[model samples]
Target: MQVDALTLSKFQGAAEPNERLPMKVLGQDDFLQLLVEQMRNQDPLAPVQDTEFIAQMAQFTSLEQSRQMSDDMKLLRAQASFQQGVDLLNKEVTVQVGEEEPPITGTATELEMVDGEPKLLINGVFYALQDVIHVKAMDGSNESQSKE
Candidate 1:
C-alpha cells in the first residue's frame, strides 16, 4: 500500500481544526487498535513473533486486572468508612470542628454519606469522620477510642 501525505499526517498527530484531540490516556480499546495497526503495517518478510504478541497480550491483561483491583480497593475503603460511621451511631463522640473552636461532645445521632464520604451527625450537625477526635461507649465499657 502506497502511503499518502494525508495518511502520514494522521499518524503524525495532526488533526483538523474541528477534530477533538486524542485522549491523554490510552485505554484497552486504543491499545488493541494500535496492536492491530502494528500487525497490519509490519513487513510480511519479518512478521512479529508469537512470543512478542503473547507478551503484549499479557501486559494488557495485567493492566486490566490492576485497574479492577484499584476500583475494588476504593469501594472497600468506602464501605469500611461507612461501617465505621454506622458503629458510631448513638455513641458519644468528641469532634474538633475547627482549630480555634472548642471540641464538641455529643452522641452520633445519624450516619450519612456526603459526596461519597462518610459523615456523622453529632449534635444536629454533620461532620466528617476525620473530625471525630474521640469516641466513648454509652454502656460504660471502654471501647476503641481514637485520640489525636
Candidate 2:
C-alpha cells in the first residue's frame, strides 16, 4: 500500500470523537499519527531501524521550529504595519489615491480597520496604507514628530 502526500496529510489531522477545533493545522498530534502510520505500513521482513525512527523524530522537531518561525514572522509583519498606521496619526502625508491621480497631501486624522487592512483617514478620505508611498513629520521634518 502506497500513501500519497495529499492522502497522508488528510488522514493525519483528523480529530477523534469529543474533540473540537475551530482551526486545525498539522501539529505534534498529526506528526505522531504519520509516524504511527509509517510504522504500521512498513514491511515486516525489513522493519525500520531505531536510528531511522530517531531521524524522523528530529525532522519533526525541525518542522515544528519552521512553523514557529513562520508564525513569528507573520506577527512581526502585522506589528510593523500597525505601527506604521499609528505613526501616521496627526502627521502630514502624501497619499497616492490612484495610479494616474496626483499625490494628495493632508494630515492623517485617524486610522481605521477596513477589509482587514489599515486605512488612513486624510481629511475625511480613506487611503490604504499600501497606497501611501511616503511618510514624514507634519512639521516638514524627516522624523516622526508627533504621536498625537
Candidate 3:
C-alpha cells in the first residue's frame, strides 16, 4: 500500500511521540486509536474505503480475543499449581531444603500458606514445593531396612 507522507509523519514523527512498538505491534487500544485518527484526518476529497474500515475492525476483534485467551491460560495455570500442592498432603517425600541444610524425609501432613506460597508440613516443619526433590511410596521399605 502506498501510504501518504502526511499520515506516515503523524504516526511516526509526531511531537512527543513514543518510539516504542507504537504502530508496528499494536494492541487493541492502539489499533482503535489508529483507526480513529485515520477517520479524523482522512483527506476530504478521498475518504477511507468502506471495505478497509471493516477489515481494521475485524483485526481489532482478533487482537482482543487473543489477549483474553492469554489471561485465561494464566488463570488456569495458577489453579493447576495450587491443586498440585493440595495433592501433596499425607504423601511421603524427600525434600532438599538448601545447600547448608540436609534433606528432610517424612509424610506431607498438611499444606500451609505462608506469604502466598504453598508450604508442606512434615513433622511440624514447613517447606515449599521446590524443596520436594523426590516422592517415595511408604510401603514399609524403610521400616524393613531399619531392622537389618
Q: Which one wins on TM-score?
A: 1
TM-score, structure 3 vs. true: 0.60
lDDT of 1 by residue, 67-134 (tens): 99999999999999999999999998999978999999899999999889999988889999999898
TM-score of 2: 0.68
Off by over 4 Å in 1: 1-22
Candidate 3 per-residue lDDT, tens place, 22-42, comes to 455657776778889999999
Root-mean-square deviation of every model:
10.6, 10.1, 12.8
| Candidate 2 C-alpha lDDT tens digits along 25-134 | 67799889999999999999999998999999999899999989999998788778878899889888777777789888788999987756789998789988877766
Q: What is the TM-score of each candidate against the true structure?
A: 0.82, 0.68, 0.60
Return the clash pairs for model 3, or none. none
Clashes of each: 0, 0, 0
lDDT of 3 at 47: 97
Give the C-alpha miss distance for residue 36 in model 1, angstroms. Answer: 0.8
Error of 3 at 26 (Å): 6.9
